[model samples]
Target: MNEDERNKNRMSNKVVNYVGFIDAPLNAKDLYPYNSKVGGSPVWMAQPPAKYSHIKCTECSGDMAFLMQLYAPLDHLPQFERSYYLFVCHKCNATRQGWKLIKSMERPRQGYNEYEEEEEEYDEDEEEEEEVQEKVVQNDTKNENGDDDDDWGVEDGDDWGLSGKTDNNNNNNNIDELLMKRDKMLKEEQAKKKEQKNNKQSTSTSSTSTTNTSSTETSPLEGFVTPSDPSNQYKECYVTIEEEVIKQQKMHGGGKGGKHGYVDDHSEMEEWSGESYEYVKDRAFSKFIKRINHYPEQVIRYGFGGEPLCMSQAGNQMFDVKTAYACKRCGKNKVFEFQVVSTIITQISHNKDVSSLDFSNLFALTCPNHCYDVGSDVHNDVIYVEELLLVEKSI
Candidate 1:
């Protein structure tokens, strides 16, 4: 559904809405790489990409900084832990290709499939087996050295007792040997049981680690580099998440607000305006202003599996799911994940010069299948998949 249909559905029913706000400037320890004014390293979900091509500026073909990453895991897609990343190339900010938005989700298993984690052979189990073997060898050596107090009860042959009791002595020796063998077998069985118990515990722990973080509890950006830049850095701040229902109702309810329902007036001709008087009457541009003006502070309009707050009237023809946004990995149509609004350009533009980054909005269309390669190690496969990022430039 389009934004109008989505809004109408919410009027009579309860719906959740999300908006991204730049909370504060990054201090020294925020862990995310928000300083890259241009595209920086992606804030990886399952595993950092083997190659850095995702964040490379299409114009410059270079790795740089000023990036924002959102750890917004979807409730519907619970099996997958999701993180959305936005990187703008301020150096090439004048062009539409100057920015790239990425969505990374890690199910640790197939998202839709039942998660039955594979049994694993932990390092500790093997080490315990080695220890048990070493102990058995040590006990055998001690018994051979006449250490009766240690393992077995086979005494020296010198104590055969009386000559008449030779047959009895031989039987006793055989019995002692049999007892020794039984004890060794019992010990080996016990060791095997212990190994099985340890392996069970290890597998259980690994199975529960289905999130982005591994069982080791490593830092979120463990293998990836923490990006930093001073001059060209896009402002990194905590995302102030708010609801549209509260703000929209408060401002417009009881006929308290403006007649246009808090929408912006686009009839005026500004000195900084890039379009002519005729261009101001464009249907696409008018609708774009109406939605954004309602929540002007929102840099992002987030509704997973929802239509984008469309900017251009002719943009939907380009966003054809059957042709343009189809999943190349799973041979299915890509679904709408989220969109980064044009207001985001104001935050990412370096030194307020966004000549190339001039776009109305970016719609992230991801695989409906949530496909990832299931490797040999089912318990620890990481996927870094890139989906379609649709850009709608001003008409």
Candidate 2:
């Protein structure tokens, strides 16, 4: 049938119910009599096709039984308040089931006449056996030779009777050997296929179970742990930045505050301008300062939270910043890391609403972990101007 016609026919005669418990028969013929997709699965389940249903005949209730079969959609099933069954009317063949209920009647086997009509012809050997025996007896009577030729028939190796018997035995033996070899090969192939299927099913089930169990008991953020101090005793490898500490050298004259504290006008909090515009004009210069002259800067590593923001006589309070990238749908976090280039005192701007001035620095950030075009935009308030130095070299 054409695709459209097949689909229409299916829609017209489909039958289905919300079956919680299906009592499938053990016999293959009775249970799996129809091919269908159950519960949205492609693999076949034991159920009737969404087509016809058998119903009881109205005329003969119990005796001389007849059945009404319908090829229609299930919408017409009668609803006795909540419960109902649908079937074709045997008398009218209409799409409905009422007093004449649809019975799941057994299919009856066909009689012998239904197979082939004509009888097989009788064998002619029985009718001709008496005449053949009389001829044999007459021929046995010797006319001229005294010796009986009947013994000669048995003695000769090429005797027709003996040859026929020997040929029949040999044919039977050859047939038996051929059948045995065929059966052995078929059994081996079937065994191999069954083993492969079982192994595949087992492997899939095991991997699924393992993955679910592991995900349930593990935490994703347990990978990184930071240390409390900056000693770096526990860390084997670390990246250190050039930091300048004020060294109060003796003036070689009378002084106070531990032989004269280093007095630099820029140290004053109010007089200090923003780090970016005042300090580092170019990223290359900043890198040169870090390498040649020690300058206070940020340092980061695996265990390090991030940049060291402040250090005081009492103690150092560092700000730990961590970024977590994740997929919106799966909630699985992605890994990412970045480096900062140079900072400059580009300019100072006043707050439009407050009429108060604040220093803002634009920082260049690049991701070292990922293979891509790196620089990204970043900004910071009045603080230290830090920049990263990187060069693109073919690897």
TM-score of every model versus the real structure: 0.52, 0.17
> Taking the tens digit of each residue's C-alpha lDDT, what string does model 2 give over 56-154?
344443111111111111222211001011221223322112123211211111211222221111123333444544534443343123323442233
* Lowest lDDT block of 10, candidate 1: 111-120
TM-score of 2: 0.17
The Cα local distance difference test for each model comes to 0.53, 0.25
- Candidate 2: list runs displaced more than 4 Å: 1-166, 214-395
